[model samples]
Target: MAGIYLRGKTWWGRVQKDGQDLRQSLETRSESVARGRLKVWLDELEALAWGGKPRLTVNAAMDEFQKEHGPTLRPSTVRRYGVSIDHLDAFLGDKLLLTVRSSDLKDFETARRTAGASAPTVRRDLACLSTVFGFAIEKEWADINPVIPFLRQRAKRGLRESPPRTRYLTRAEEARLIESALPYVADAILFAIYTGLRQEEQFSLTWEQVDLARKHVTISAETAKGKRERTVILLAPALAVLKRIPRHLKSPFVFHHGAATTTRGARRALPSASTKKDNDGERFNHLDRGLRNAAKRAKVPLLRWHDLRRTHGCRLLQEEKWTLEMVRDQLGHRSVVQTERSYAFLEVEDRRMAAHGPGTNPGTAAAQEIDNATGEPIAAQKPAQGRRTDLEKLKKSTA
Candidate 1:
């Protein structure tokens, strides 16, 4: 006969045969799985137990994960995962997988927050750990994942994510910022604005991906954030920008960084190469200082790299009046929900601005002034006096 008991969401079994004692985890939270496994153990196999879910440490599991799964992910993603491993390794060093309790994870979360990690960042680290634990489960190194339950509990308690930022640059601000940027950063900035590319995607662009003859740029499947290849239609401005980019003799990078001299945190000369490096690695990132300098010089609000992408969407929807689906496809967003949630406010504000006329206060226009066809109010050259509502008009007429 064999007896099984629950321990921290897992079932452990105890059995004695031929005056020898054996105890092991039945490797499931469900009573039914425990019973079935116990019955099979008693009936079959000369050895009685599961050889005790292999005694491996968290660090060791992380190592195996890196060896197995790291190569398949993007370099930036791999780097982030590596950072997460460092955090977990320090806290859970030499801790066995089966012995890890929910309390331990909670402690890690508290310690991480106390150490100045934001809630969202800590959540990402936990997610990375959960991925590692899932890998261990697949390898049979772990039976019970502690992260799953902890996350569930935290979610129920309303541990929330910060709201997405809606920062965008106006046309004038965009021009000034580009003018103030150094040559290399300026090119990257323009590329980001025109194509709505992510920092990684734009900076990592190579000569091979650009097709000036076809009047489009190809974002390959591996390079794109959504992991799907999409074409960026090169409009007149984008084409002009592309044409103006100075061609380098040997470098395959579309936007090449030219070295001037030794500054505190500025430019390092890259070694010139003959052929294109289409390898799925991140570009050498040194845009922070230049971006700051550009913002300072332009006297504009400091815009992040992602903000340029937002600006692209803003212009298209606000000025061009492109549909949400069109913007979504152009931006290579996974779904329309993301497109709408992030950029819908731009369209709404543009409409409001149109209704009031740009010179006047927002939303202070006559309802009749709003064009029914486009849902945008016609702007008059000489800004009209703010339109009064029907009630105010009736009062004024009576008076």
Candidate 2:
């Protein structure tokens, strides 16, 4: 049996079940509404006691989930999930799992946003909370999942999402950045720009993964963020960077000492300075700061290692020789949409170039005569047959 009570202006229901108490807000002011909710809650509690499905405290489900799950995920990922769990536990307190409502989740979002949390950050926490709820459902500790419904109905994607970055380096900016950086840092920037490898892939790069003869570098599943193995085809510039990297006796890492600061003469005397690395992922993890410092010196805009990866993706996708499918695979993205979101900076660049470009529109030349500035009849300009042949030859050579 259940009892209904008027709490302030709202209704709440409480029932005794399996020697424990279940309580939740009915969220109504009317007496009839309170009694109706009490009846339904009593029915549910009776079913639960009769072995319909057990329930859990939010804390209990999270504990069991962390203990039971083992997917060989990255250490950073484990830490991130732990952080999300900590936030959820703090917010939930001793709340029961099944009583979580979509409204409660919406309240949490409003509170977090008020406290300066971005939508993406709140979304991540919700996703982790949903995972915990899913685990509870899997163990039959809860009959319903609350988070998924909330995410779908309450916070559809793009609520307060920060804009995706479109800042990729131009060739001249890249050259200036490279020249401004230290030797090892410069090599890393060049390699990342050419290979489209993420920062972790770059940090975890080892001699074992590189095959000079095969012209490829294999990123193992453990080292890659997507937990999938991928092979990056090495171009001539990448190969040149590889050949020039000085290997040392202390480490087998491909890129070491990104923060290495030594005069050329001193570096020559102590070749181990270049290889004086932990040879682990922990070392040089903060290489972005080094790049920023070099950017300050070079007078280029502050650039991240990821921007180089984007630059590579944009360049490859813009090239006439490479197919979009090929670029998507090379970027190691799960979908073309992911590739476009990150590297589609080129879309705007190309459009701007074409609109104000030096030449007449090739497609429009033979189709019809139209004014460039206004929609009016004008003399049609025809490109010569030889000029078209020259364009074909250039495309063939580039391809």
Candidate 3:
């Protein structure tokens, strides 16, 4: 038999079974409602003690899921997951794990959208929740993964078109950017352009990575974006930049700016630091600001810092005439598809040129007829006569 006591408006039960006393709270403001709820709760507890289902809270399940699978992810990936979970915890705190419905997820999606998160960003957060719940279902922590089905259907319908991707720096813009950057930053920019090294890779580059005699740079797995080791063949321009670097046998960094040493607590600090002028660590920001100012001064289009990398890829595609595979290897891309996706514009321009053929204009049919009658390519004819004049002068000078 069970004894029930009324505490305020709620009822609590105390039952003695097998020499053990068990307590259960019936959460209700009405004594009659609490009494009815307590009877059902006791039955459920008895069934659970004899191999029935046990309910879990959202917080407990998430904690369990994280403990089991969190270590497999990379540090950066783990940080991103933590951020997403924080948002979910804020919304669904105190809810039972199995009680969360698809409608709750939809409401959360709406709230996040109203708060100005992009669709892609929201999708990624939802993906984290979906994965967590999926794992919970696998572990028998929850009967169904509410986030999974919602994510699949919602993701397709809610997909937003991403921002336009930008690539490449125009010649004049490149020149102005180089001229404006501080000496060390200019060197770093040139290194990035020539080597196609990512910003983090450039920052963490060591003297060991460079082979001056071989004219190559070996990027380690830890520094590379793809998590794979690769080597970049350094051209003469890239080599020249490397040669100009003031090497210290003791210092490991390739570009150890004075600003970095002073502010970042490098062993050898810079002397006579200025409050107005940036130190070595802050020099990158100054260089970025300088580029913006230079773009304004030159009346050029706005360019991002990453435009240098795009310029490198575009130069390889256009000037060097490197194959897509070659560009992929040089840029350390994980897949050729990534390279093509990023630089397919170059291929489009090439195809357009090929379709029209060189020196032919659709708007100038008469000019094309004149060129056809001349029996010469329009661009080659002028250069040929100029070369003839130079050849005659050269023969006269030799005689």
Global lDDT of each model?
0.73, 0.71, 0.67
lDDT for 125 (candidate 2): 84
Estimate, for each residue in 289-328, the C-alpha lDDT of model 3 and write its tens digit: 5455544543445666677778788878876889889999
TM-score winner between candidates 1 and 3: 1
RMSD of each: 17.0, 15.7, 14.9
Between which residue pairs do clashes occur in model 1? none
Give me the runs in candidate 2 sitting further than 4 Å from their true place: 1-54, 156-160, 265-283, 340-342, 358-399
Using TM-score as the measure, the top candidate is 1
Compared with the true structure, what per-residue lDDT tens digits does model 2 show for residues 1-399?
578887889989887766778789987999898898688667666677688754456887888888887456676677888988887888884687878888778877887788898888888888888888888878888877888777776555565446787767665566557766666667788898889888878877888899999988999888888878989988777889999777655566777653243333223232322433333222455478658856766555657778888778766765434776788778788877776666665666567658877324231123234455687643322212212232344456555
Please give, for residues 1-399, the per-residue lDDT of candidate 1 as tens digits.
569988898999888877878888888989998999888666544432536566667887999999999888877899999899999999996887778899999999899989999888878888898998999889877787889888888876654466787888765566667666655566667777778877777767787899999988988888788889999877677787788775656667676543221232444433233134433223445476767767777755656778878888887776677888889989999899989888756666766666866734222222224445678743322111232232244445555
Enumerate residue pairs that collide in model 2.
none
Error of 2 at 76 (Å): 3.5
* Candidate 2 global lDDT: 0.71
Q: What TM-score does each of the candidates earn?
A: 0.69, 0.69, 0.62
Runs of candidate 3 exceeding 4 Å displacement = 1-79, 93-99, 131-148, 161-164, 248-251, 257-302, 355-399
